[model samples]
Target: MSDFLTPKATPETAPFWAGAAEGVLRIQQCDACGRHYFYPRRFCRYCHSTDVRWTTVSGRARLDSYTINHRPLRGTESLSPVIALVQLEEGPRMLTNIVGVEPDPANLVLDMPLTVDFEPRGDMTVPVFRPASTGSAEGTR
Candidate 1:
């Protein structure tokens, strides 16, 4: 197993983890404000409404920013991880790893389109992003 720490699902975030296990990206939406958010909380980040529900998203996002991590977790040292912040189609920004491409500045362009994919960490699955272009080389990690 990798030395990377996996996320522990809580009552509020259980749905998100369950969706990822099923290869679906799930986030929370506020019924009252009609807005979506991430990090799994009981109330909406925008409107502070407790009428939030879990919903599956398109898994499409745009690369906003990133940093190439030369030093990764113990077992994942072979994979130079690209830590990225992506803006989802629903307007929520999520911190995820950019995969399916080289971990270099030229390859990690700003505003590049991305699609979600899951990576197994221990017994849990986590979301990762890949370049939208089919021509890009397959994921290195």
Candidate 2:
């Protein structure tokens, strides 16, 4: 009873998604310069170094920008996926859909901070984002 949109991942990005299943956010970090990146790659795009390794992040980011997509489509009507672009705190932007939220202008606020959560897909875990707590002593930026 679960037919979710499964993203095609390659060797470069597979570890990232796999980590999500274990409740971790994996991003590539330059072993030489300590620069972190998203959309996992073999080489560091920042310093062009092959000395890159996947590291676990805090599973946190911010809503850089988003759109409230109301257009309904087959297979997407029931879920109402909110397509969005998020900016990770480590300094990279990624295209993903937010979950556990209504796709509305009032809900998708620009520059609103967020944190990552995982959704179970058959045999895999996908990373979704949600509003980050801004009030708690542990959540304050």
Candidate 3:
């Protein structure tokens, strides 16, 4: 499904969407403390500084936690979803969906490695994660 239905975008999230549309997966990095952050914002959550700028990320992440949702909702149709928390290599954890895999809990767990992939929703590209890169494995970051 398209990300337009998931969450509303604001000015703070505009650049993020813009970058996603370009397959760049831009994330916020604090210029002060050199810490990276997800869920796009203007201030660094750690340092309390407004010295934040958009920076390109490798989109490499690990599966911090997740749940396979088998129930259908009003908006979602036939496909079951894997609601997940992706811990990026830069220390920021992001709430996202796990795509291109079977939605099974045993197959997904804490600290499992992950990598990012873009699913096109109209003109925007939403970042979805998959199993971590295994070097020669398919969809490796």
Candidate 4:
């Protein structure tokens, strides 16, 4: 077990974490409905079919929403991470941390183009996002 706090992986979520460890973003796509979804599951949220398969994604996303934490959680007093929901390019939204930028509302614009980055925590790797290096800030509301 790792000293770092992390979500316990169920069988369904293992592939996601495995892909993260390899620096790849992974999600599930429903073969039946042609919709992509996050938080690995046995069935598709759209079609309710068991035909979902793990797929690698571009790791590019848009910041759908976020909140900056000035207060640190217990045992993590030295770090303040930005909690955010990002809409993946493949159209799935997932909870993640926003990194490589000031954790302020003025800097964390909604719909900002973002790219994935990973941090190793004990036995697991966590995916985080940052503003895309080459994109304009315009319309990133």
Top lDDT model? 1
Quote the lDDT for 88 in model 4: 89
Checking candidate 3 for backbone clashes, the offending pairs are: none
Misplaced by over 4 Å in model 3 are 1-7, 78-80, 136-141
lDDT of 2 at 35: 92
Model 1 C-alpha lDDT per residue in residues 24-83, reported as the tens digit of each score? 999999999999899899999998999999999988889999998887767776443899
lDDT of 4: 0.82
Clashes of 2: 0
Give the per-residue lDDT digits (tens) of candidate 3, residues 1-141. Answer: 645355455899988888777766788999999999877777999998999999878777888888877776755753339988888887888888888778877788778878887776555567888887567343334
Q: Report the Cα lDDT for residue 83, model 2.
A: 78
TM-score of 2: 0.85
Where in model 1 is the C-alpha error above 4 Å? 78-80, 134-141
Query: Which portions of model 4 show Cα errors greater than 4 Å?
Result: 1-4, 78-80, 135-141
Q: Provide the clashing-pair count of each candidate structure.
A: 1, 0, 0, 1
Error of 1 at 43 (Å): 0.6
TM-scores of the candidates are 0.90, 0.85, 0.85, 0.89
- Any idea how many clashes model 4 has? 1
The better-scoring model by TM-score among 1 and 4 is 1
